[model samples]
Target: MKKLSMLLLASALALSLAACGQGKQTGGVKEPAQAQQGDTGKAPQATSKKTTYPLTLKDSSGKEFTFAKAPERIVSLSPTETEVLFAIGLGDKIVGVSDLDDYPAEAKSKPKMGNLQGNPEAIIAANPDIVFAGLSLNKNSVTKLNELKLNLFQTNPKTIDEAIDRVLLLGVITDKQDQAEQVAGQMKKEKQQVVDALKGLKPEQKKKVYIEFSPGWTVGKGEYLDDMIAIAGGVNVASDLQGWKQISEEKVIQANPDVIFFAKGVPNLEKTIRERSGWDKIAAIQGGKVVGLDDNLMSRPGPRITKALVDMAKALYPELVK
Candidate 1:
């Protein structure tokens, strides 16, 4: 029971903070063409276009933040933001990171100030020109930071496309436009790759998918994971529900997903899920199609999201994707 609760809290922290809106179920995202790959696998040298200064843009919160020039010092309270910042070549400008922002190796050595519930004084003391935050930040923390006049830029990306948009937006504000575009281009290519692979799949061929981010918890319609399932050429059986919600075993038995995916950290994922009472008749359990996906890749809404998308497609249509 304790472990299940912990998993639920963790899922909320990882997703509820970053995702906005219920599942839009766009089927699949049709992104613009990816940038032509260079000989070095880098985004080809982009034209020297600069983000003219005195720039103003809105964060996911719809709050406008203006920058006189590129911010020299930065603080990030979201792990996804940390990854995006690094992807855009802004690692050196980071002054502080949340305790949990361990990624890309370099972030591990960054000054650990706080996370969603970080102390306002420590962040203010870091003297960061801007702080990247998300909905995970405690209401008290946000209030205090707002009172202190901190430049808190909250990012809420509900879908893979919006996540890519965030990468482009961060690049523009920090004067790393080329790097950001390259990252976005790569994401688009990844998305297109999965789409191309599933082109021959008919609506009838699409599998019914059920994903458990945590024990007793599953994503339904209007959530990022549900959309990912659609993009990967499958339908979320729980699409009838909305957002992240606790699911009942009876529901799983009735919906009978063709494939089931769970967060990877759990031990004996297949056995654990298969043994659930009344689940013996489930198609996924009988066919041994239970899959364990990397929790981090499944959770974070950043450059790695497409990796999850690719993974989901591979799991559903292994013969096609490979």
Candidate 2:
């Protein structure tokens, strides 16, 4: 039970991360003009202006940050934020990243700050103009980072759409509004294409999905993966449970989902599932429908989640999505 509990905690922390909400809301601390909210499979309109400085903004924690100028050096404690920063052309400006920031090939080369709970001493050593953090940060680390008074900010997005807004919001902070618009615009369009393709899918038409992202751990409602499954025209058999949970092998055998998604890099998950007693009766295993998705794509809530959405939609309903 101790190991199972640890796995559950790790699954939640390892996967779903967050970011900012919509920009252009009426507020004192403001961001650049936002792109259209309705996803119509079109690129966001380009704005000629950049993010104006003396920028005042709010982090996901509802803490405030004021930027006197576009930060020349940045440290990102969130892997998703690192990816979003890179997407908005701020890659060159980033001086450090979380141990987990591995996308785009370039981020991997940056200096590593510890993981979600950042290394405050290392962050200070990097001499960042600003710092971006993830939700999984431990309370102690949060207090230490705050005590050090390091131009700190945070993002904690619960959904993919929220992730898009974070991409735009980061632009607001870094003076990369145009690049953010273009990047998020592409994300919106790609996601809309998936939605359009899956439109009017009846509950019965959708595949029943079972996802085990970590060993003995799965996600349910109120989290990104379940939301992704729904958008992809699939039903989560685990939705009866809440966010990130230890799996019940008996329940899984009973639900007998049509498709099973396992995080790609977790060692031997597929093999374990296949070899598990009484799992042979599950339709997915018998039909060879178990799939492995890229762990980063599935875990990190960033601009690339749209890519994950498209991939998921295609996986479940290839005939419709294609």
Candidate 3:
């Protein structure tokens, strides 16, 4: 009877051990499966939660600003920002514009605040939900806006990529992300097409080009105009200088660029260039390679920069671009 009892106890212990091992193996397999299922179920919820408002972001000035909700009444103090707002389908939300915001035709109808030195009182009187200002806004104005507790965002893009980023940022703040993405995507596609077309040209093959915003104002390094010039398969003659500077006629004469581009509405641009002393002897003038481009398209840091690239490419390499 003692041996039978011990044998029964040993069999019961063996069955318990086997069941424990099986349970562990089953749990090991099922746990990972359950965890994976849980993660999969959570992914959509996580993704959908993105971009919910009271969104916060640092502006170009590195100041943190929070939007309790998407701004419905926007005041644009920069023409470029105005164009961006309109491009992203926020035109109806625009309550006021700067004196210089004269694009899209509709922007002209908005009440004018002030120019680079934005009128704080005028801006405040507009009762805007948010204000979009340029980098040129004075420190005092910014301080005044801060004192008034006005939500101010700065739009200052030094490059085409920065411009696109600003557009997307505006879209986020205005709840027009999809439209902004579409605009940005199209800009990228168009810019890439220009880049791809110019990719095959060797450095030596690139044409020497000159661009004049006015009689003396020209772009240099660190400017999008310079980037556009290079992207269009041409070298900016004034690139040696930095930023917007007045170019000496002697320097321009020395550069003798193969092509010359002037911003349109420069008051008799062709006539002025043709009449300039010694300019008649320049290679561009002699070859009739001088071209006039739309001022806003080339100068404004907006979605139309791609159009500027196409226009510039057409001007520089007429055969390569249609």
Candidate 4:
């Protein structure tokens, strides 16, 4: 009986020890290393919050807009911004575009949101993160967009410097600063080359160029085209007037421009000025210096402006093809 009781006591002690070991294996004991973390399955917390900035942008019409964050899905409501977007390598992010954005070939593929003034509904439907426009964009529409909580960036570039600055600004907004700088640098180089090419040409060697736009409207002094004409090594014969204005037919004859550039938008324009009324007497008509050019290229302040300069050079100075 005593031996049996002693054996039973030994078995009870072994079972008790086994139970303690199993408890330890099941993680019942506190571990200092494991207690360092607040929770086992929780992910590591972030050190800081993401940084954001409030940006204020002014459009051509002197309107200002503020944004809390950078816009991703941009809707281009102006042809200028569309061209700028493509120039700065943000073309892929364009969610919507205006009907006027015909350059870069890819613009045609983007969803059309109608004209700038009447396309707010389409814009809202597209749900773009931002809208890019020019001075011509309607204030009411802009207000509506704002009410819908869409960010708007309005750009109006009057001079070449402004144009370059606008491109860089767009690049910054789209997070493509390096690409914008490269494009701006290339354009600046091309412009310098144009200026350099015209170094020695005398005023007499330069053609008297007339850039005619509608029936009576023509680009005068203090316009983008005038700057391009001077840059492209041609003297704008109509530089006497300020801005785009109407002038008499007799005045065109009096100026006697050696070359007349008919921008594509002119009404009733034809090969022969003789066919038109009150224009045959002009010196350009007599000398056959009328040249048709794509107005979009000349008017737009995008990367293609350099190409327009080259085209003008080709037209004005055909002899120096070497």
Candidate 5:
């Protein structure tokens, strides 16, 4: 009876161990498959959270610019770019500005890097991620900075449309696209309104204009000023000239403009024209059709151009404005 009992006990113990082994196998097989499914579900979530970089581009003047990443600190080599940055609500990101950037009252507090010929060392010390320069910047200076792997944007805006485009570009770089769009939109609307208001006038009624800078210095044909004058309901008398050139009194007399625009504060302008030798023979001088343009507003590439255009339109077409 004891031997029989031992055999039965052995069989029971073996069966119990067998069952435990099966349970362990079942758990091990199921756990990995369930965990793998859980891991697969999480992978897409992480991938979707990835951040994108900003776009990179080269300006019209061949300066390389990257906007794929938002820069924490920026420098403006051109006064116009500095003013543009501030205009686009990037005052906080601007660490340094050129001396000529004086429009925004808040910009005065920022460090000035002198003029467009600003010291590169001062700019480097600022540790800016991006730099803005005008197309007129000395090429050697721009090349030196570029060799150091510094990103730069060179703007050369010759027309009002180009100026507005610069503002939009700055906004994109600084992450202020909405505000920039709004400001540019308003300027465009105001400009278009002025253009539409004067569209009804006859060509004969339109005055022929000549923009005189100095005794001999005058805007050539196809310049931005010429475009502005045409848009303001005046014909450019010097449109025949090749480019910005020094015109002789004979040329001015031959053009016979009905109106003359003199940029304000030009040295020896009034005195020179008064003694212009043969300038009085021109119809503009004889008819008192000379108008002076504010240097600050008309000369810079900014929102002020819109104001300049509107003012010029009103001045040239007083009857239309009324």
Candidate 6:
């Protein structure tokens, strides 16, 4: 009986030690299944609290403005500015646009303020966070907007390079810097491609080009169209003049350009050019080398100017580009 009790005691002690070992295993090392359900799982991701506002930027006129937050309701007083805003993914933020804005098809539906002379009352009624204007905005209108403590940014891009820079600046102000950089970079790349394609042209290979916006209105040395013509491997015959001005029919006849480009929006433009009294004598008319292009692409300093350059190059040198 004593030997049997001693054996039972020994068995009990071994069982107790086994239980303690199992307990330690359960408490110290978790099973794979338990790990997936507990502290080993991913922690909740923290949200970014970076602020893009209290932003200050200088406009083309060297005037500075500050924004407390990203502009939610932007009023674009210039059609070019309207295009720029839309191109950089800020179309949904636009509250108002100028009367002349028609590109991207959506801008046409936006509330239209007056062109050149913007309606201050209408602009104020829109409750815009910011306003983008051109030099056409009269001094009185600017004063009224100022009196109301409204933010008005003037966009005056004199060259294609400046226009691209403006896109980047707008991106910074609107909290879409990445999108804007992509747009500006693509534009620069496309423009440089065109430049590279035409860089090897000899002086003799360059064609004399004439562009007529209206009946008598032609682009001159300082204008974007003139620059486009030169970049597209053509020489603007009216480069002697500066800015948008009328060239006498006599001078146009003397220039006798190899190609003629007319603004596409003008009514009966091709017919008007063909029926002009002495135009039949012009080389372009004789060779039927007249092409029509979108006036906005040539006029507006926006992202689409690269498209305009491609169109102009194709029109001027069909064999080379194709």
lDDT of 4 by residue, 9-117 (tens): 1110001112222121111112223333465867655332122346444444444545565576889876667887888788878989877678789999999988655
Q: Stretches of candidate 4 above 4 Å error?
A: 1-57, 65-67, 138-149, 264-268, 272-274, 320-322
Clash pairs detected, candidate 6: none
Off by over 4 Å in 3: 1-50
**Model 5, C-alpha of 94: deviation from truth (Å):** 1.7
**Deviation in Å, model 2, residue 106 alpha carbon:** 1.8
Displacement of the residue 279 alpha carbon in candidate 5, Å:
1.9
Q: State, as a TM-score between 0 and 1, how close model 4 is to the true structure.
A: 0.74
Tens digits of lDDT, candidate 1, 28-109: 1123355688688787543544666677555665666668888899998877788899989999999998787778799999
What ranges in model 5 sit over 4 Å off?
A: 1-52
TM-score of 5: 0.77
lDDT for residue 108 in candidate 1, whole number 0-100:
94
Looking at model 3, the pairs that clash are none
Q: Quick one: best lDDT, which candidate? A: 1
My TM-score estimates for the predictions, one after another, are 0.85, 0.85, 0.82, 0.74, 0.77, 0.80
Instruction: After superposing candidate 1 on the true structure, give the runs of residues whose Cα lies further than 4 Å from its correct spot.
Output: 1-46, 267-270
Give per-candidate clash totals.
3, 4, 0, 0, 1, 0
Which should have the higher TM-score, number 3 or number 5? 3
> So what's the TM-score on candidate 1?
0.85
Worst 10 residues of 6 by lDDT: 8-17
What lDDT score is found at residue 47 in candidate 5?
16
Superior candidate under lDDT, 4 versus 6: 6
Q: Enumerate residue pairs that collide in model 4.
A: none
